[model samples]
Target: MTQKKDTILSREIGKLGGFGARLVAGLLPKNIFELTIETHSPPETALEKAFTILSTEGKVIEDRRIDPNKPAVCAIVGSGLGNLNPALVEVYVVSTKENITKLVIIGTAKEGLIKQYAGEKAARRIADLLTQVLP
Candidate 1:
C-alpha cells in the first residue's frame, strides 16, 4: 500500500493561521510536518474529537478555541512535562478525507522543538498518536 501523507505535513494545513505561524516561527519545517487531515469538518467539532484523543494521554492544560478568521479551525494548548516552562505546546486538528483526522503539534520550545520533534520519524509518531486520538 502507498504510504499516506501525514495530514499535518500537507499543504492544506499550512494554509491555517496556527500552522502557518508555526512554520514561519521555525518551530516546524515544511517537509517535516503537514496536515494529516483536510476537509469541511469544522475546528470546534473537530476539537471535541481531538480533546477526546488528547485525553487518552492525560489532561490538557487549556481548553480549545477556533482561529478567529478560521472558526472551523481549532487548536489545543498544553505543556510537556519537565520542560523549562509549564506552558503546553499547541496542537491543531483539522478534518480530512475518509473521516480521518489531521494533527499538528507546535513545540513550546520555539527554538529546538522542531529540530527535536519535527523529524521524519517524529512526524510518524505524532501521526500515529493523532490517528488514535481522533475518530
Candidate 2:
C-alpha cells in the first residue's frame, strides 16, 4: 500500500515570505471590514507563493485545513498580521474551483493581536502591489 498525499485545505501559515507578504500587502483592504483580492492564478501556485512570502516575516500561529466543498476558506494566524495600534494584519487566501484566487485581509485601528489593522493607505498599497505581482 502507498501513502496518499494529504489534501491541504490550507497550507502551513509559515509558508508565506516577503514576496508573499508583498503580494498580500498589495491586495489588502483599507476602509472595510474585509476585502477579497482576486487572481487568475491557480490555488496551488498562488498558495505556494503566499506561504513562502509569509514564512519570511512572521511565524505561523494557526494552520487550519480548508474544506474543498467551499469555494473560499480562511487562513488564520497568518504570519504576524491582523492587528492595529501595533499595526499587524491577518491575511486570508480565498480560492475557487474556477481558478480565481483572492486574498482576504482583515484589520482595523484597534490594538492587540486580535484587533484589526490596515487603513486606506495600506489597502491602496496592497492593491497597487497586486497589479505588479500577479500575472
Residue-by-residue lDDT tens digits, candidate 2, 1-135: 011101111122113333454344334332334556778876655555444443443333333324353322222222225321112333456556576777665432222234243333343344444445666
lDDT of 1 by residue, 25-67 (tens): 4443332334354334445656666555545533354554545
Q: CA lDDT of 103 in candidate 2?
A: 68
Q: What is candidate 1's local distance difference test score?
A: 0.40
Number of the top-ranking candidate, with TM-score as the measure: 2
RMSD of each: 11.4, 12.2
CA-RMSD of model 2? 12.2
In model 1, where do residues sit more than 4 Å from their true spots? 1-36, 66-87, 93-103, 109-126, 132-135
